[model samples]
Target: MPKRVDHEDRRRQIAAAVRRIAADRGLEGVSLNEVAAEAGISKGFVQHYFASRDDMLRFAATTLRGGIEERIATPLRVRDLLVALLPLDDAGRDDALVANAFLVRALKDPEIAGHFRTGHGLLRDAVAALIAAAQADGDLAQSVDPAAEAGLLLALVAGLGDAVLLGYQTGDEAIALIDLHLSRIAA
Candidate 1:
């Protein structure tokens, strides 16, 4: 009997392969051949989920952005915001690597770039909203400029992600650094 296929599961598996490929190889080198080999699936099977290399990349980008957005929206106390943004372990590092890969790919592809920009804007907006809410509740400092501070928070998150991904810092160190950064924030 043929092996049963779970279409969504297989699709997610393929997307995971896409992230690994881009993480290991530059995005320009990503192809069905390489992805199939990396994923340990047939080349034709890779095509089953994606029509072309671009489709695969786009799907991967969408998936990564969706995940980050979901995490950002998680109902956490204001104090946990920075902690949620910081990658503090193997799982977090892998997720950051995947996120960085998508952002890097966006640098060269217009379609990917648009998605990246939109995602970035959404994150910044969320940060602003959170900060503003905290300040209104008298939980944040009145002196902080929500918009400017939100941008800074986003930059710090990106820097922390890069440091963790590049081995410049361990996950624990990253989390500690983020805590220090958070101490300076209004809320």
Candidate 2:
């Protein structure tokens, strides 16, 4: 009898290790050796899961996007969805760190850029739909274009996250600014 290994879990763990490294030191020098050490697993074990560093990073990016999608999933209010996107907590901060790390990489890597573009488009679409719904219900001003508003709101959220990460502002202050923006746009 041999120990049954959960392959998907192992892969996810390895990806998480990547995120931790990216969050701590950016993604420049991440390697299988470093990832294996961070994951407390053997280098051979990591290679068993990921064929190459790019493969591991792609999986990690997918995992990061999936986490964001989960946070903004159904049954949530528009404000809740927007709030979920901010770096208001430790997990959110970690996600922000990983996202920012990949953002720089996306500048030079088409595959990574594609991943980010798809995620951003999906998130923008979802937010636009929510804005449209709010407008329909008369909670938000119908005078504003939902798609344009969504794009602006997403940009604001990204900027606020950066501000928080850079110590330019606190998370609570960012949330207050977001709420103020929402109030001004209210119906």
Candidate 3:
């Protein structure tokens, strides 16, 4: 018999290791040796999955984007979005840390820039769609520009994420602040 293999699952676990590294110490600490050790795999195995640092970063950034999309697509009420906007929970905080770390690298790494641009554009479009839905349901102002509103929502989300990472406010307080923003936008 041969060893069982689940390539996609293994890749996901590797990327998750990358995300964890990024969250804890930023990209500067995500070296091949460290990731391999953290993932409990050999360095050669990690290299087999991700040929270089750029590939690993791309996977990590893409994973981060997938997480946000999953949140947006989940069957949650408009009110539920208030909770989603806050990154005060451990899961949210980790995601925010992973995302910002990727953003930091994307600024100077062209190999991974397309991955970031695509992920960010998709997230922006999803937010725009959410705004359009709110308008259609008479839950938000009719005059809202989906693009501009999406930008504002992105800014708010980013700010909240940073605050969460920096420990400026607890989860409940962050949720309350997000609630206030939602209230102003509600029709």
Give the top-scoring candidate (TM-score).
Answer: 2
Task: Between candidates 2 and 3, name the one with more favorable lDDT.
Answer: 2
43-104, model 1: which lDDT tens digit per residue? 99999888998898887776776555556677444546666776665556666777776777
Ranking by TM-score: 2, 3, 1
Query: Which candidate's lDDT is highest?
Result: 2
List pairs with backbone clashes in candidate 1.
none
Worst 10 residues of 2 by lDDT: 69-78
Error (Å) of candidate 2 at residue 77 is 2.5
lDDT of 3 by residue, 38-109 (tens): 899999999999999778777777677666665667733444654675665677777788778888888888
> Which stretches of model 3 miss by more than 4 angstroms?
1-4, 75-79
Q: How high is each candidate's TM-score?
A: 0.79, 0.91, 0.85
What is the full ranking by lDDT, best candidate first?
2, 3, 1
How much lDDT does each candidate structure score?
0.76, 0.89, 0.78
